[model samples]
Target: MSRRTLSILALSVICATPTLYAQEAGRIQAGQFDIIPSFESSMAYVGNVAYARDNDPKIYSWRAIFSPELIAATQVDGNPVQFGYRLERGVYFSSTPDDYTDHFLEASGEFELNSRHRVNALAQYEDGHEDRGTGFHWA
Candidate 1:
């Protein structure tokens, strides 16, 4: 199977695990703490403007995310988890006369584990890059 397919399958299994789903009402009502982590990466290109010629430059970025949920009987934490992936790529140009522009892409996915709880996973692929990387994430 392709890497994408395999990654998705693994995420599904982990997210759907009984341990993640079997949190009884009593547990939540009493009080509990949950922590989630995530990672993301993106790439893009830069170009020239009206007066200047084409100047192509590429950029890459990676980010880490952390979310904590606090639950109490009186004040419950709204939802349990939130997760997703985003991809962005664009071109820009600046010159003495004017400027130029381009476009990028984005995709995301998430799942809610009832009215007060949620889970999610996501991945994104861009157009141009030498090291194309995808992450396996869950929250």
Candidate 2:
């Protein structure tokens, strides 16, 4: 399908879904921190399960994804701090070899350096992989 058509379809699906709020999605107050847990699951028809090369025959499949995440936020001496961890697992019905699992970790914070200037920093770590036959071989 054309990009434009896909974009429109995606938009339509999003609009048709009921509105959801973060507070309702997953929020828990713990002491001085808010611990939020979220889960996302989706099933889609994948056109290319193996991410086949141009010359290779196409391999189609059905893809199912399960993603879960946890976020903690609080204030340190009035400075905001946040940390999050997310895990994603994908399963392909027709192409079991294409299944994958990934992890992502993130943290950010703000510090008051005196009264006039403030410092903000963010750090992220990801353990992820691309589908077979995709991306370059750095080696």
Candidate 3:
């Protein structure tokens, strides 16, 4: 084929390529409820496991973390409401006594009595432990 014919064929093929779009695949609906679930995991090597300030022992260890979350939302009586739960777990290879897990729970609601007035409320609960020397922290 001639050079001009080859150029036209290449141009036509490029213009005819299809376009693609991406959509969220993690959302699910069940009986007036919207549920979304997600998870995250990580692993790291720590040269010093102890969060010491002075000349404390510098313990080397490997840490692994895993976190999972679930969210559910819906409309109740013309009001928007949502609930969520999350769990975080940590494991230490050398620092076995420092291994810990945490839990968090939360809920929120929004109400509109009229066009001129609105009300909202949120509640949260957390159960966890802080690092050494930081004192105990919980809510």
Candidate 4:
């Protein structure tokens, strides 16, 4: 095959690949509720584990982070309601006081009283900790 034709074919394949794997934003319907679940994770190499300004000692370690969330929604009396929870965790190879896990809770709902009026509400809470020196210290 000619080089130009091969290049065109490669470009077309690259453009079409994303559509093949794309997920629809619509939630999964289970009974009377809609559910959506998602997860994310990352890793990094830290040359200086502790963000020390000067020279006591430098610790090297690997850091990992993970987060997962679940969302559920339902229609109540022609109104929409949603509830979700997310958890985040971080760990380091070195057992410094920096490793921690956090939890978050969220709730939201919408109501339509009439054809021209609507109401919405949202609430959220978090229980977590910050690493030393980066921000507030708990110890």
TM-score of each: 0.19, 0.76, 0.72, 0.67
Among the numbered candidates, top lDDT falls to 2
23-126, model 4: which lDDT tens digit per residue?
Answer: 45646888998888766666667877666667657777666666778888889998889998889887665644778899999999999999899999999999
**Candidate 4: clashing pairs of residues:** none
List candidate 2 segments past 4 Å from native. Answer: 1-26, 137-139
lDDT string for model 3 (103-137, tens) is 99999999999999999999999998776545754
Q: What is each predicted model's overall lDDT from 0 to 1? A: 0.32, 0.80, 0.75, 0.73
Q: Candidate 1 or 4, higher lDDT?
A: 4
Give the poorly placed runs of model 4, Cα more than 4 Å off.
Answer: 1-28, 136-139
Per-residue accuracy of model 1 over 1-139 as CA lDDT, tens digit each: 9864575455445434433222444343223532222222222232221222236343322211122222222213453332223332222221212211212233333556587986665444444432211233243
Pairs with steric clashes in candidate 1: none
Candidate 3 segments whose C-alpha is farther than 4 A from its true place: 1-23, 136-139
Model 4, global lDDT? 0.73
Candidate 2 displacement at residue 79 in angstroms: 0.8
- Tell me, by TM-score, which candidate is best: 2
Q: Cα deviation in Å at residue 10, candidate 4? A: 34
For residue 99, give model 1's deviation from the true position in Å: 15
- Sort by TM-score, top down from the best: 2, 3, 4, 1
Ranked by TM-score, the better of candidates 1 and 2 is 2
For candidate 1, the lDDT comes to 0.32
